[model samples]
Target: MSTPTAGQLALADRIAHGGPAPVAAISHVAAAAYTDPARWAAEKTALFDRLPQVIAPSALLPRPNTAVPHDGFGKPLLITRDADGRAHVFMNVCRHRGTRLVEGMEAQYAPRLVCPYHAWSYALDGKLVGLPRADSFPGLDKTSYGLVELPSRETSGLIWFAFATDADFTAASAVGPDFDAFGLGGLHLFRRHTHDVAANWKLIMDAFLESYHVQRLHAGTIGPFFKDGVTAADKIGPHQRSAVGRVAELAALPPGDWPALRAAVTFAYQLFPATVIVVSPDYVNLMVLMPRGHDRVLVEDFMLIPEAPATEKARDHWQHSWDLLDTGVFGGEDFRAATLGQQGLESGAIEWLTLGTLESGVRHFHEEIESRLNTG
Candidate 1:
């Protein structure tokens, strides 16, 4: 078995107990948090624009000179790996005319990108390499026309993009190095399920931050595996990790076999701003929430496993797992509730809603968002 990280150790202790202490009591959050248009715009600028956001798995660009184009957040962005085996991100636009360059996230092996607009091309490293009709434009220096490079890093098998090109945030500082415990770098994408949820991004996120609803909401699927309202949550800067213990299975083990507890619990990490990762015993499910409007969000669910299932039996196993997780927990229980909640809140029936002690993680997340918007 792989060695466990500090996070795993702390989680094991909490599983031995019932749960972690509640951080705060029941508190009321304004309804505008989900229905205000101006507040949504401010959140986009303060959170999405200023902070580093998880874009795609680093495995997407596996080989040198490979690239994937992403436009999830309304801006065309290119993520590529150079011949020298370094990762880079840049605005997917031609410097000459500002036309969009790449189209989709398809893998391409071209060493250079040619903009279809004016035949201008850029190297894999974002340097302007080919320009049609160079002499036609006098005193036009190619050195000053490279694609706009953004801050990017590959860590824990994921690619992160920060809009604040020069900021104090680092991947290690934000999520910590302990994520390697998941052996994420060794896993490959098994499948991806996308959903356009009819609710605010925060509302969708809040649904996953706590296991308080598992007993009542997910009782048919994941609820039976966990103890009700029992979770261990730890905040690592803006990022957070919460684990739900498996009561019967864990308690059945003898005290001497306690080290095996890692297999008896599920760990969830709230990677600041918009990504949520749930680490189960068999696989890891990553959710990326892109807020499209005040009451709309585009959610991408990436199912990762140790490797692509080679046999028919293995493939069937993973496929069944994905179906259950997608329909039962996320779509059926979580997003369904978020959509209904949005409808009620939009009706002006309530000015504010209260979160109880079991929902401390939700409260803390909202507090962080408010703090960033106020300070930024």
Candidate 2:
């Protein structure tokens, strides 16, 4: 395991000393932020489209010549790793007649992607390599007819792609070192599941931004493992990193024991706009949230383990962990809360949602969103 970063160590120290978590004055967010179509449209343009969004964990395409179709952003996209191990994000449209090229969500190993409509094959690098019946068309330049690609960067074991060609990725790239410290790049992807929830994407994001709801919302599941209202958080550019855990247990560990410190804490990162990465004791969960509409969001959740299970016993252990998270904690608790919150807000009973001090992260998140939407 990689050593904990300085920020992680500082968080551990604050928790050990019973230091208060960062707090913000009470704030209110208009209920329409989650329901207004006009607001949603602006957010999609200024936040989601104009920013670099996390496509997937590096482990998703583990090797060369691997490809996967991604439509989470409502834009058909093909994620491919060429023979040289370079990752590319293409428009998933064939140059010939603008036909959709790939079909499913599952990743497949293929040297070339062939369009079902016409058998025009493209190399993994988005180059038109072969086509049938060259005589069928005159003045057809294979060089000019290739897959449409978006700007993409693979760093710190994650793949990030931008919808706008000139989107600045500096804020997104800042999280790389922290992810590297968690050894996220080399982890094994054990399972992936997609969730369609009837809630605004930010509603789902708000659930993970604070520890205020853990003990109450997840009381029946993983809540007992955390200290009530005892959390530490920091902002990395627009991103937020929050940590909650067995503070007393961590305080008992000897000094400079980085591994022990990590094992005692649960670090959750909200990669501004949509993605959330939860670093658990033995595994990590990467969530890519795609907003389908004002009231719906699609979450692609991935469970990554230390390595591929080598034995039945190991598999069982990882399976249990996955079940506890995928089904018990996240699906049943966090997401459920978001759905309920959305329902209540849409009822028009409240015009403003209040944020307490413990939920300062939530306030900070909305502030960041407002800053961008207003400036744009």
Which candidate achieves the best TM-score against the true structure? 2
> Which 10-residue window in model 1 sums to the lowest lDDT?
167-176
- TM-scores for all candidates: the values are 0.91, 0.96
Residue ranges of candidate 1 with Cα displaced over 4 Å: 18-20, 133-140, 171-174, 227-229, 247-259
Across 59-78, the per-residue lDDT of candidate 2 in tens digits comes to 99999999999999998999
Clashing pairs in 1: none
lDDT of 1 by residue, 220-317 (tens): 88777674425778888888888876666666766544346656777898888999999887798988888899999988888898888899999999
Clashes of each: 0, 0
lDDT of 2: 0.89
Reference-based lDDT, residue 326, model 1: 81
